[model samples]
Target: MTKRRIFMAGAMSGLLLPSIHAQTGTNTRIRNLRVLCGFPPGGATDAVSRRVSDKLQGSYADVSLVDNRPGAAGRIAIDELKRSKPDGSTMLLTPAAVITLFPHIYEGINYKTDDFTPTSTACQVQFGFGVGPGVPSSVTDINSYLRWAKANSGAASYGSPATGSLPHILGVLLANQSRVALNHIPYKGSAPGMSDLLGGQVPAFSGLLGDWLPHIKTGKARLLATSGKERSALTPNVPTFAELGFKDLVMSEWYGFFLPKGATKETANAAADAIAKAVRQKDVIDAFAQLGLEASASTPTELGIRMKEEFRLWETTVQKLGIKIEI
Candidate 1:
């Protein structure tokens, strides 16, 4: 298998730091910058946006805030972003799935990948499949869980942070490959879905590794497998889906920034520079690590390339799955 290049905050600093410059405005500071998050507050997307928003204050703008437009599996924020000004005052920090996977899976999606200009990527996260108390203790690993699900098809259901998300796709892929009857439950965000996972409202869940880490540590959830090319360092004992015989499932999701279409390259560069600087900070890096994300930065051009690559990759995968969703 080919290895994926992992960008680090430190490695990108030398390339991006020199690009940071002051944008011309009142008192040399932009006022009331808003970073939009598609998911509700307290989820991974919101956390990354809030952290970067704090760093953006004083330098990028006089005030920075996270605008939570949570709905329609993150499409709400995308629509809101399309209507936002292209002056760099507003930015969207969202999962790559909304750009890469949505167009493939969703019907009547109003926004296109080109509707927004790529700014910078905040971080990348791996997905994990976890089981809660609702699952039988006898089901320990992916194979056992699949067997249990097959035996109890009526009760076989999994929750994902949102519909048509990478986690949701991963769940569907697993069921298709294993020939198991597993239904999917979509949530507004990880917090509410995770609550049900611990409380046994759903027997299984596929979501970001961060969503399950705390519960797993507290013995409230059991991680079955991760979706990555290699084993996750945080859960070394937990095998990856590839290691568990699902080679096609190796994938990861990233949180990236984007400005609405019609934004100038200079404006995009300024936002990118601020985001690169912010994501590389020691505090930001440590905080992201706790959330099972690898904090990193990228040039706007680099982000655009990565986004296209991901879009193509998900296009092929979604085509193979033959899944199209409405809304």
Candidate 2:
């Protein structure tokens, strides 16, 4: 064959090889999606991840599994995701605390918000402050609670899920704003923290609404105020911090999905579309509602923007509070 013909044939072969291989099923089917959650099973993060995964499974027949890699305040799973292939098959489902707050609070975190491609924000969950029944204050709102707490002269202590978790930060912020001196206590997990609160071991605890809802209903603990901009639908009578004149006290934990960094924009968009479809399902919404979590999804761009805003807010708060740790 002529030299030009030989070169042209080789170029055509190069183009057709991949197509032939793909058609032969040598390419992995875009099924068997794996989702990573950085919390143990039965935790709020785990519950939300599973709910989203089930919805995704229903919408996309390919999704087959959801994996939990809970450790180091989500850093372990996040690091694993960073080292994963930049393919669409592996997804990380986690709360905003890991991405936006961990890097600022912990000294040795290896993954940052930029390390992953955001797919979609699945939901925003509100937090509530619950005081053990032992506290003398029968206050129902933040203002009254703060006033009573101040009168107690730092005797009131609050428990948080972990040392540098979102609830810890919220407790610190609440003390700073309300001029209430509170001794901060940290627990290994929300379950333990809620246990102490229910048993009247701690005067108060601040964490996810889901963790505190049962205790609230059982009259073991009283809901002081929600940390969101508005009252939660599950607890409409509970006033928000903003309504009580603490506008800056807003805090809501949120979860989002991410693919490894450098994934193609097409792949990211496809994942986001899939999650959005999943979020719209009635069963998914109802399931999350049962956990006191609002079911919603945002575009990848919106997730990015929200992450940036949250990072800035947490950075400032951490610096202001002088919270430094080596987790």
Candidate 3:
């Protein structure tokens, strides 16, 4: 049979026949495909995981599932992934920080960057600093808040998702650039930290732009500044740290897909192709936008390059900041 006939047969049956071994023509049927997520069911990570799983299920002929294994800020789920066989049956959909930053911060983590293969980035979201009533009504933007922090005791305090997380790093950078003494309060996650920020328990909150955008719209919180090269599309009125002169402060969090390190080239390529196709769909893009996420995709090789670059960048940043976590 011609190769075209084989390809057509595989497509019709929802199977990838001999994708990695065209010469041998060993047909591989993908089954019980699991997309593992490290966070709880309702949070951002789980949400993104389920979305991708839904899209892939529609595209693939096999059953796809999103399995949440929440514990230790994704370490448990990652450990589960590390133990799984690298046969393209299991994949992880998680935040880039989990792969890029966690190793440097946690002293006793179970996984390393070498344990997985990069597929594609699913979406990107910006970071921001939010303010609540503890900050005086006169304070509007980052510069004014900096000035106010210098005089007020609790005004300069800020909360982040966790120690050594990107938001924590942002606060550290802000202190260094503005030469202000800002207290860094680390929370288990952004939800509770944002809660304090909105309840006046904390004056400032540092986390994703999505976490605070809703409250900002309702007049319940103030987005002092965003952490991106440019203002977020959803909050154009707010200035970015870079535009305000701290160009180094620009950053974004990403959700990305990864397979086990030993997965075959054909497996990785097919996975990347599926995700690239899914994210480009108008409905998927619009859904991501509504969540304040920017939909994006990259080839497996491009994702690998990004992973290596980000691993280097974050490694240096963590070292320079002397950031570490007890657990």
Candidate 4:
């Protein structure tokens, strides 16, 4: 039941930006760059931004900083981003859900889909529903969790990063599809949510796989299901929602970089190339792979097309899922 959409154009359109550097063949236009992150320092999105910033030092002489501006489920940072100068010095690197899902759910957002230029998609992350000591050990996977929810009235509640977030919406979809009621507990961010899970304050928690994978590996929390179509390479034994016959529950999470509106094509291309080169490095890929995030970089055009497609896809999916917030 996964919603399928086809992207017609090829992803790679070789741009001359890589070679169009100074005749000296040095990338010397070193301006201090700021990579804006909407989430706090501990989440997957922030982690990816820091990694990219670290690796980018090799591509340019600029001093890069990963700035976290967390609030309103990432609206604050994005609003700031939309208002910044159109120069390529400042960019937003955060989860695509903030771009694709927020406009539909949150009212009075200052930015629109066209407000920022999609630069590159850094990588993909999937969600996980992790259970802690508050839950009975008999409920192993999402299927059994649903069955248990039928028997246990209010005990079927789950915690997510925040309200109206992908995890929150996915929790609602799970309740609807499974024909059971699942309450939601929204935290300020994933770190707090995971902390509550580890402390057994919530019966279950939904967060990116990276947020819960280490706990799952250390036998502290049980990852009942992932939101990917296929099993994660880091935890192949764990079943995905699609693997459990809930195909419509699948939605891929991507961390994307976007420049301020009106950034020149040359600037955009330079930024994209630097990021793509940084992510493709062996150490970065290996580190990301441990968290089940593959190092996937896309051209600016490809990211733009993807943003449009995702915006459209989410419009349909949110309506179908009947997810609307009064904000």
**Candidate 4 residue-pair clash tally:** 0
Q: After superposition on all CA atoms, how large is the RMSD of candidate 4? A: 8.2
Between candidates 1 and 2, name the one with more favorable lDDT.
1
Which regions in candidate 3 have their CA more than 4 angstroms from the true location? Answer: 1-29
CA RMSD per model (angstroms): 8.5, 11.7, 9.4, 8.2
For 129-183, candidate 1 gives per-residue lDDT tens digits of: 9899999998889999999998898999999977778889899989988889899
- How would you encode candidate 4's per-residue C-alpha lDDT over 61-90 as one tens digit per residue? 356677777666677677767876666667
Estimate, for each residue in 140-235, the C-alpha lDDT of model 3 and write its tens digit: 989888989998855579999877778888899999888899999988788899888888898998988888868988998989899878888889
Poorly placed runs, candidate 1 (over 4 Å): 1-29
For candidate 1, give the lDDT of residue 46: 85
The clash number for model 2 is 0
Ranking of candidates on lDDT, top first: 1, 3, 4, 2
Q: Is candidate 2 or candidate 3 better by TM-score?
A: 3
- Model 1 residue pairs with clashes: none
How large an RMSD does model 2 have?
A: 11.7
Model 4, stretches more than 4 Å misplaced? 1-28, 290-292
Compare the candidates by TM-score and give the number of the best one: 3
Query: Mind sharing the TM-score for model 1?
Result: 0.85
